[model samples]
Target: MKVKGYPMLASLLAVMLLVGLQTPAYGENATTRATWIWQTDLIKDGGEELLHFASDEGITLIYLQIDRQLPPEIYEAFIKRAHENQIAVHALGGDPRWALTEHREDMLGLADWVLNYNGKVSTGARFDGIHLDIEPYVLAQWEDETDEVISTWEQNLIMFLNQASGSDLELGIDIPFWFDRYTLGNGTSLNEWLIGTFDQVTVMAYRNQVESENGILDLTRDELELANRLGKQILIGVNTKEMPREPHTTFYGYGKESLNAKMEHLSSALGSYASFAGIAIHDIRNWQNMSSDVTVPPDEEEPTTPPPDPDPDPNPEPGEGDRVPDADPITRDPVVRGTYIWEAHEVIRNSQEILDFAKEKNLNWLYVRLDLEQPYTKYSSFVKQAAAAGIEVHALGGHPIWALEENRPRMMRLVNYVKNYNRAVEGDERFHGIHLDIEPYVLPAWRENSQQVISEWTANLDAFVTELKKDSNLEASMDMAVWLDKYKVTGQDMSLSKWMINRMDHVSLMAFRDKAEGSNGIIAVAKEEIAFADELGKPIKISVEIKASHEGDHITFYEEGAAYMEEELAKLPELLKDSPSFTGSLVHAYAYWKNAKP
Candidate 1:
């Protein structure tokens, strides 16, 4: 936040850093903390002054979004038992499909469910990573109609913040304290693609009901004086719960002990001329998950003579003209087609028998898993009430601390607890994309503790889908299936066609498994896994498995194996005609259209 020249962004800032992707081995611990978001839903609706402004006062980073999603061998032993009790896990990348409720691939499927669950809890450790709570560029009021799609997606979000830029994995951008009334800060393209790619931004600052015990809590000081006059690094946002706005028009939020005395009185009145780099509690909010008693110490010091490293040696390699650049033109957009049901939890809580079997069968996508070791807020409120009855969400759940493999600071605080699982509603402003049903595995008694958590979950799911396809306000993917050769015949050392081949646009391949018994024949195994995901050249999206486990008594799909898997799944136009590595097909469920709309 010390903006005098905002860290002197030397020359196009190393071509704005991040180009190819995959960073985050996580080690740094410089420590100047303060990133909390413990959603104590206003101390059970704002009572004990939001629990004495949260456990006796002075809060530090606590952010929580855990609804459900956990199975990578129980979230890698659940974030190494919460960093041996230090409590630093913050992932909350959401999906209520913002942009005033359009489909825009459900904001790129909620930036592919927060970059493959922030690449499976930043597979390693030494925590403190992401917090991008999907704020759909401000649901389109002005951000200049998406500022030329955010200046052509700020060169792939500076190559996904140069592979999610980091020291000990750090990146934040929960934005939307409404650009603090635009004093140039709002010329817009999502506020110059988030003040030109984030290293810090957290906002949603606070909304409506304006205050009460600490009632209408404040602190949007114009997006913290425009990220402290553009040195860009600030975190404010409010709302510990009671949302309302118009009808009941609530907003009177506070109570994690009144937003921790409103973030230590806005970091003691904006820490010494705005270097106050932390607060972000608008969500991960719910009061019961308390524990703050009082901490807020780090008053921003280290300047004894520090700040020198303009290019000091912290792994600064690239000089020989930094080669490996080209290939990211794929920019994730296989346009996410339909019908997906990895672990169909009681068929979406039987929402009218899965919307009368997806309107009688012409199914149109419904990939739901919603996990993080179960009891997920009633399946996250039944996939946000099945997207108000149209249906599209995809999550498939994970995180018992991502099977704690990389071990580095407990996998970067479990990649900020799965990137702050759906921060109440900016990206989830409701559903479409937020799926990374990531299914990594290896055997022979867990291959070397699952190869540093499966190569840190394949380089953190391709740097969380190249950092939410360069978050011009997120779009997403990564729902691979058909057990890619049974994860290489169970030895489980998969690169996944060179790690998500050309890094996602959309990918689906559950080519009817369990060794196609009496025949799920699987259209010649979905044309040999869509020609091995089109020989891994990338641009993928190939599906097939339209009817499984039927004959009642809990799944056996009888009627002659559901009529020969519906006549070999209607022979898929003679098994994908001239397969250009096809880009669609997803069934094996609303129970194979119970008789009409797909």
Candidate 2:
């Protein structure tokens, strides 16, 4: 059925369902696609006009997918038209299953040809980068092929980028937005592998879009907030045309007006914290020549629940040059467990000390902060040693650069660098996952005001994690909040921890900052976070503040508190569920872990 003929309500729902990576909603401001595209996939005629319009409208990027190999002449003409119009061009993926599964060498070679075509089109063409929309495991490849896919992506793509690094070419990879947060069939440890490798990363964040029936802005806000937070140079996607996703016609795409409105709202919400470097328009096919008059309304409260994210990472290729040491392959303890501080960075500034501490106390995992300036060796070595001693390592990330509020493109470089270093230098067995410590407070002041800024922040985070997983065998876990269970923290305006964690291997809750009197004790609160994870069947972990985080105002839970908690923890197994369900406990800091024990 045509979109205009669909029930107004249904069409509205379709137009706004998953606008900002969160949910379907009313007339709230929409997030715009920064990198707009003239997708060849299922696109109608006059696709060039959409590219022209995007360029005229000052959109930053455009992508065109090639169905099968094209003749050089046809490819050159397409490239020339885009360049003549001054639009940036990138590739979109839709390889036939046969090419993807059986004709592996040919498929990657085709990608290389396209990549070369993109290069030959212009300097870097309109934008200085290349994009791959490899939807992994949509169906199975041979077990051997799984590793081959990643190996080829890295060897070919990274090699290409390195060759052009001196020439000023930019490169990036695109993946399903939910990969980092959700466990899915075709995911990869891409961010980790490509860190230091790619120029930027984009995440696709739209599906089932719709405006609220009441025309209120509740649900849309949540999604936009999520998209803004999840990826680097995130380019959260929103479809320009109104159409139903196949099979069910269940999910609808976004309209131009709604998307623009969402972008404006996101800009307002994120302010300077708004790292939304830009938006990714799904297709120019749907974008009409004229702009829409859709006005984003103010946001309202969202639904009590949200749609689920894929719930659940990577490893090595067989090689004579080196055989990866076999690992026992320990799954995360079902009980809520989390570690802080590792994922990016080169050296664990204080390693030997931290590992001894984690091992002695029986902690399940350790979050290691490897300073990016240092080579990966110091950090990678520490993780191997720690894992050998029966403790897991989780790489932690904090910005090495002081300017956190830089443009999306710039920040993406930092994220990619960190993730790439982790994968290239570290081992799959030594670490359980990459842990994102996305403390938004440090963002440039301009970003502090807008919630969309936070969404952008998250998108960048997700991009790094997703990309890394493409190359490695680890899972993706992020540190979220303890506040999600009950009360909302006023003015903070970040994605709800639950909302963000919906796509994670499990969420790690930093459950502290006691303000009100008579609140549940820290362990009680931690348990609450775990319970929620259990309810969702998503694994959960807690960062127990064995010591007070700061000496100031918040309740100080130092050694005395740690001991009290440690004693309580000794009895924790007796309180309820299976031992595995509890995972393991994470204490705050090398300083604190040094002192506490069960």
What TM-score does each of the candidates earn?
A: 0.32, 0.38
lDDT of each: 0.43, 0.46
What would the per-residue lDDT of candidate 2 be over residues 455-548, giving only the tens digit for each residue?
5555665665567567666667666646443322224332245445545776666655332122454455555455444544566654556543
For each of the candidates, the C-alpha root-mean-square deviation to the true structure, in angstroms, is 22.3, 22.8
Would you give me the overall lDDT of model 1?
A: 0.43
C-alpha RMSD between model 2 and the true structure? 22.8
**Per-residue lDDT over 523-584 for candidate 1, one digit per residue giving the tens place of the 0 to 100 score:** 44444445544555344554444343322322223234445444544555445555555644
TM-score of 2: 0.38
Task: Give stretches of model 2 more than 4 Å off.
Answer: 1-350, 399-419, 422-430, 441-450, 484-495, 513-519, 523-528, 549-554, 559-561, 576-581, 595-598
